[model samples]
Each structure stands twice: as structure tokens, then as C-alpha cells.
Target: MTQQTTLHAAFAGHVAAALDALKAAGTLPAGLSRAAVAVEPPRDPAHGDLATNAAMVLAKPAGLNPRALAEALVTELAKIPSVTAAEIAGPGFINLRLNAAAWLDELRTIAALGNDYGRSTVGAGTTVNVEYVSANPTGPMHMGHCRGAVVGDALASLLEAAGHKVIREYYVNDAGAQVDVLARSVHVRYREALGENVGDIPEGLYPGEYLIPVGQDLAREFGDKYAAAPDSEWLALFRNRAVAAMLVMIKADLALLGIHHDLFSSEAELQAAGKPDEAEAWLRAHDLVYDGHLEAPKGKTPEDWEPVELPLFRSTKFGDDQDRPIKKSDGSWTYFGADLAYHFQKAQSADALVDIWGADHAGTVKRIKAAVAAMTGAEGKPTPFEVKLVQMVQLMKGGQPFKMSKRAGNFVTLADVVEMVGKDVVRFTMLTRKPDAQMDFDFDKVVEASKDNPVFYVQYAHARIRSTLRKAAGEGMAPSADHLELLGEEELGLIKLAAQFPRLIEAAAAAREPHRVAFYLYDLAAALHGYWNLGNDRPEKRFIVAQDINLTGARLYLATQIGQLIRNGLALLGVEAVEEM
Candidate 1:
């Protein structure tokens, strides 16, 4: 299929053609790279409809002054029928102002493409595996894991929208000491379910009341079969069952926020397959692993520090602070050891890998990154990889910290928040800030009807458009493209803003930042609301005109397209574009 041409893309081709013309006419040098050439809207609308740094970006390499290059470029661009004016701006930036007909044509593009309007092929032929919300299978999902969950899921969808095959994955940390702790915690609850006074959750085990049901099921099933047995007789059974139960709860919690992963990999399964052993042998053969002793950790008293010989991966070779141990002194794999194998496994089927982790894992980012680089680069096709750390979210209400849920035992469960405010609000609110920045999820402000509330404001824009279209239809007027030329300056201005969606999607996908979608949607919504306000003072400007069916169809056409674009964007964020408030 031929790619649908967007306004930004069309003008980008024009700028490139202009440069090519300069080269062909012997006015400029040949073979200059156009990698840095970009077409985007001017920062201020008053500047122009669209601006390009083609002249400015090419001037230095082409050895011509920016202003001179811009002038020549403007002369070439002025030949295009759609470009009414092309002018040189500050330094060498060239800005183009198109006639209203150009934008009205783009509004037609929105109608032709509908849901496919903003889709881009920027990431075509690349497969990205996004691993996120790998919260340990020890307890219920909570606000602590919320930000990364929403960010990662939305990012996966954004990549898909940008034309990449995305694998939405979750790594189950059902291995090492943590799951064992979870198993024992369930055992304590099991005895309690069996009418034994297990007492107030002994230290060093999960104490969440969410485990009560799991323990009750186990008690009813086993009927004291392993209640008094030694740890060797029942540890594995309880561990497997407990992890499965916790995962069920975790999945349910994530579902409440509209999240579902395509794959949930198990650490224990990876180890049982001897993947870690396989990774070690290959790294050692490549000299990326060696037996070494780590220096005493920082802040440890010299008298308290002990050095032990262990097999360490040469992570320092790839920019880590130091070589890292791959195995404990007792010959068991370290968490980093298993993690390295897991990353290598993920690199097998993907062109790139992305991990969304909590800020608490900040300290481990480098070594794991180093391992991935070494492991994948060795195969002569280095895979692309990135780790995004989502910072903490403080839950607040009534101007202070919201109390934790007793059912969750301590923290505010994700389910608790979603139930209180609805799934759309929780997901949208989680994405209001960048993943790396700290944010507060305030119960009071998030649901407020004011424009300051991004979720409410953006959704209100879509709802208003739908209401307008419905009212117009009732009066026998419907959206049409027959009189699109009737759309005026204010209407064209809205199209100019809507026209940026294609560019925004590509840029956001390239940057791996999904929050940009949220920010852009809010701006578009603001433009819609601002245009609607203009109609309050001018009846002819309203979307519906009983006396002017042709003009009303044109205006309603504009509103319908705007609403469709909003729905397209909201879907990428896994949010709902409500037809009514």
C-alpha cells in the first residue's frame, strides 16, 4: 500500500526537492547528508504554518552562508502551488505559509484515513520487545508499580502505532529468595486458616492480608498433608502454588488498569533450562568472564569487609563501575547472573529491547546494560536496548498522604485507586508526567472538572465534539466534504494543529517517550475548546447552523474529523474517548 501523505511529510519532500534542485543547478554542492533536516511547526503560530531547518542544517556542510542558502531555497519552494509564501526567518530557518486550501485538504485526509490518519512507518521492519511491571510475584500490585505499568503499556502501543511489531512482555521474578519468602508467608497463613494461631506475621515474610485467600485454598486442598512436614517435603509445592496465586492477583490488578501482557516469563524456568549456565560458558570463552575478587563495598568498615573469590563478568569493559559477580560464593547464580541470561534470551527474537523498571532498581541498570551490549554485540549484530526508570508516585488526598489499604497490608493497591476513579482516569493520570520525574497522584485534583485536569479536559473535548455532531444530525445536517472550501481562518487554525499528529507520533516513537502523546493531546484539546469558545460570541461560528446547511455540513465535517483524531490518539494511550461526559 502506498503510504498516506501527511501535510508535514508533503512539505518535507518539497524542502528536500528544493535542496536537490539547488544541487542539480550547480548552485550547491552534492552528496550532503539530509539526516538533520526536519520539518515541524513553528514554535509560535504567528511565525508561519510550517518551518524547516533545511537551509540552516545544510549551510555549514555546503559551505554557504545560512541566509544566502535560505533565500535560494525560498525561491525554489515558492514554485510549489500550495506554498503561498516562503520566507527566511532568524539566521537561516525557512518558514512556509500555505493557503487555507492546503489545510482544508488535510482535514479531508483525516476523513479519508480515519483511525489510520496518524499512523507512521518510522519503525517499520523492527521488532521491539517491551518488558515492564516485572514486580515480584510476592503480593498484590500497588501504586508503587503503577507508573511504570502504564508508561510501558502505552509505549508498546505507541510503537505499534508507529509501525513496529511490539511484544508486550512481563518478566516474572519467581525465583531466588523472594519467591521462597512468599511460599513461607503463605504457609503461615495456611496454618492460620487451619485454626492455628499463626500470630501477627513473623518478620522477614510478606504480611499482606491479600494472601488470606491463597492460604485458605491451600488449607482446604492439602488438609494438613504438608502442614507438619519438613521444608524439603513441601517448599517447592507451596512456592509454585503461591507464585501462581500471586500472579493471578497481580494480573487482576493490572487488568483493572486495562493492561495485559503478551508473555510472562519465569526466572525459575529460565534457570531450570540451564540458560544461566549456557551464558556463563559463552562469556568465559570470550574472556568476558573471569574468576576475580571484588573490592570491599563503599562505606563498609575495613574490619568488616571480606573479599571472596568468585566468577565475575567483565562488566567494567562496557562502562560499568566494576566487574560484577555472576555467581555467589556457594556457586549459585546471582540476580544479575540470571538477569543477564534473561536479557540475552529476549535479544534472540527482537531487533530491539526495552525494559521499564522502577527507580529502586537504579543501581543495577549499568551492569545489565553492559551485559546486554556484550552478549548481543558478540553475535556480530548488536541489538538495540534501553532501560527506562520510572520514578516514585506519592499518593495524596486532602493535602496529605493517602492512607494505605488494610486489605493490602501496607501500600495503596493499584486496584483501590482504579476502583475509586475509574480505569481511564488512573491510566491518564499516571501518564500526565514523564516517567523519570517524580509525581503525585492526588485524589482531589485528578477528577476535577477544570481544564487543569488533563484527563477531564481532553475527554471533554471529544465529548463536546460528539454532542455537537449529534445535535447537528438531529437537525438533518451531517458532516460533508462538498463545501470544505467554506472553512475559514479559525477552522483552518484547528486543522493546522491537528496536522501535527503524524509528526508527533514519529518523534515520540523515536524518543521512546509516550508522555509526549499525552502532552500533545492536551494541546489539541485546548485548541478545540478555544475554538468552541469563539462560537459562544458568534452564532455563525458554531458547528451547527440551521439556516446554512452547506456551511453547517462543512463545520460539522471539521468537528467530526477532530473527534476522530482525538479517538485515534486516546486509543494509543489505552484511554477512552468518551462520546459523552
Candidate 2:
């Protein structure tokens, strides 16, 4: 079903219809604005089940006071079959309470839709390119890359769930000074593999031991053939081999977290294809770039600073602090220039673009946004572009700082964390916090089978529900809606929480935040557990009441629906819901 037909959407439409009724009665102006009206769950459940700002949003335009408009709107809203009460609060806000039967119907919808209950058409199938975890192809991915990788993958999934055609992409930084260092490091290990005693790695080069295997492979194929050659003679050959091998390890690291990119765009390939040159010419034709000398950088000046003309993009016109240099004095493209070209090429196929970057690149957002605006301007239409800067994750074990990885030189590798805990834990924990906030991932806490561990807690709730269903099935007690009318407050409360999933998924996808799904799952699990504990004091509240088959069927239906909702939520986060934890 379309999002516009959901329960919440129906209420929003009711609000609009009420406004139109007021307009028909000439109680409100003909051109009253309803665009700002929002129908959503109130911040405090005690306020009401759902609240709307219809009166407050349109009062001034309608030439009526807020309370006056609210009073008029409530009359029409209360006429809705499911709306039992509509009350005007403190100034103008209208709070609504739907009958308990409304939530029961929502539970029926969940069972009918099953896994597709939360899917939405909010994105309208717009093509979006999500480029993330573009970690340099010089070594295995470290902990620093974990957050963005998970966030990007989850966001892509979320967008698709919201009906966006999303392309998961990884831009490989294969052409740069760093890859040269990787090649040199691999050459050192190659010499050692050829029976030459290579000393300690130099200070400026990569010192990771992960390259030892790559070196051994090279030696096995061509034993010391390039070991004694000049640096110029073997640099390109070694760089290509090293980059290819490192990418293999990188892809494997991503696999550990259940991530796979639909495309791996290479900077080297773009440069070789002269895309950067084309971007420079395009910007030049638009007068977006010009040969200019920049002033000394603020707060710090290099000792070798000198005035020299360079091809620069007028990023200052598009909200950047200063004009950005696109080409160096040597007529070579800068990193930003190559990145701009890549984005330009991406914009050709996708209607929107999103980049998941480390927080360190926060300073780079404006320049890239400026470049996107310039490139998309040529097409005579604005394309949506966003950069999500993911903060770092601090790893801990036993309450002490945990930081060391031979594969990544000095930092903890993503594979290391995934191996310590399973992929599901790693992914859910990464999404526990918003991407812009710094978080601590304690190894000990995530694996604990307690309420404090969100992933385990949510998984356990699903498992418990499944176990209850299995017990009922063994006794020939299948879920039946014959006694659905017997469900009470606790049952309806759980259903209300489950009903929010479709709305929550749409909002999270629009906001590009997957952590909302995590938070919602936590709340849903808590609601289920709360109702489950109620069975301790009130045995009649339990799912499998042997004495009353009808009640047992009803509670079992609720339990099965809750399990389905939890499973659907976990799927969005790329976490599996196990039948047994």
C-alpha cells in the first residue's frame, strides 16, 4: 500500500478534509495554508495518541485565533469513524485519540503485509548514488572506517525501503602518494621474501604486516625480478599489484560487516580517462574557475609559501570560506579536482548523491557541495547532494582502551572487531549512535545478554516470541483473530508501538538516519518485554493460556505480529533476527 494510505496518512488526510470543510463553511479563508500541518504521535503519550498542528498552522492565514480554529476543526475531526476524541490543547494544538479497535486493525495490517508492512513509496523511485567507505586502497580497513561503512549500507537499505533506487558505491583512492608508499612497503616485504634482509620500514611509509602476504604472492609469481630494478622501473608495476591486492583485503573486511558495494569507482581510472580535464574545462567555460594566486592560509603559514598562479574554483560564491584550488602550479589536478570530476560523472546517472565521510572531512563538505552545484547547473536543474560525516568509534575491551592491529599498522581493523563479536552485533552497535556523534564501543557490553545490550535484547525478544509461537503450535493452538475483540490496554499499547514502524521508516529514510530504526526497535522490544512480564502477575495475559483457547489464540496472534515487526526492523539495519538467541 502507498504511504498516503497508511493509518497516520489517513489521519493527515482527515486533518486536511477538516480544513477544507472549514473553508466550505466560510469559517476559514479560501486560501488557508495547510502545508505546515503535521499529524504525528505526540511527544508525550499522555497528551493523546496522535496530535496535529492544523489550527496553529493556519490560524493567522484563516483570520481566526488558534483556539477558535481548533474548536472548529475538532468538530469535523471527531466525525471521523475511528477518532473517539479530539481535544484542543493549551494554545491551538489538536490532540486526537483513536479507539482501541484502531490499533487492533493496525496489528491486522502488520500480519497481512508481513515483511512489507514498513515499506514506503516516499522516495518515489528517485535514483540516488550513495558513495561511502571510499577508504584508500593501501591496506585493510581499520576501526575508523567502520561507522561510515555501516551507516552507508544501512542508509542505502533504508532508502530502498522508502522506494528509492539506490546505488551503493565505493570510490577507491588508488591514485595518490599513499599508494606509492604501499608499493614501497610491499617491495620491502618482497625483498625479505627473496632472502634479502630488509631493515625496519622507514618513518614515512606504511609499516603494516598485512602486506607480507601480498609480497609473498609477488615473489612466488616473479621471484625478485623487480627487487633490484630502479624505483621508476618498478614503481608503477608494484603500485598496480599492491593496489589490487589491498582492495581484495579491503573487500574482505567489508564482507565481515556484511557490506558489498554495487560499484567501485577508481580515481586512477577517472584520471586516465581525462575526466578531470573535462571538469576543468567545464568549470572554465562557466567562469567558475580561473588562474589566481591565493593569500597565505590563516593561522599557519608554510615556510616555503610563495605567490604563484593556479587554476582555482570560485567556491567562495557557493558558501565556502575561500576559493579552492583545483589545479596545482605544476598543472596537475588536486585531490579535490579529481573528486569533483567523479561527482560530476556520478550526477550524470543519478538524480541525487550522498557521501558518507569521516568527521575529519567536515571541512571538505562545502567545497564538494559547491562543485556539485556548478556541475549540475549545466543541466539546468538542481540535483540533491548531501554529505554525512560519520564520527569516530572508540573501541574498548575490559574498560581499558583497545587499539592495535597488525593489519592496519596501529589502529584496530574492522575485521578485528567483527571477528571479536559477530557481524550483527557490530552493525547494530555502529548504528546505536547518530553518525555525527562520537560513541564508545565497549567489547564486553555488546555481547551481554541483558537489557543494557540493545542488539541482544532486541534479538532475545524476537526469540522469546518465536518460542511461544512454537509452543502454541505444538498444542495445536494456531493464531486466530476470533478473539481479537478481547485484547485490552497492554495489547493495544504494543500494537500502537508496532504501528509506528511504517511512519518511522519513512521519516528515517527522508532524514537519511538509520539510527532511528535502531532506537525504534529498542522501544518495540521493550514494549513486548513489558507485556510479557505482565503475564507473571496476570497469568491470563500470557500468550499460551491452556484453559482458554480463544484468549490463547488472540495473545498468540499479538506475539506473532510483534515478532514480524521486530524482524522487519532488523532487516532494515542489516541485522538478522534469530528464532533462538
TM-score of each: 0.95, 0.94
- Relative to the unseen true structure, what is the C-alpha lDDT of residue 95 in candidate 1, on a scale of 0 to 100? 87
Total clashes in model 1, counting residue pairs 3 or more apart in sequence or in different chains: 0
Highest lDDT against the true fold, candidate = 1
lDDT of 2 by residue, 283-314 (tens): 99999999898988676567767778989999
lDDT score of residue 131 within candidate 1: 98
Residue ranges of candidate 1 with Cα displaced over 4 Å: 1-3, 22-33, 59-72, 299-302, 379-381
On residues 485-504, what C-alpha lDDT tens digit does candidate 1 reach at each position? 88888898899989999999
lDDT of all predictions: 0.92, 0.89
What ranges in model 2 sit over 4 Å off? 1-5, 16-36, 58-72, 299-304, 378-381, 404-408
Ten consecutive residues with minimal summed lDDT in candidate 1? 1-10
TM-score of 2: 0.94
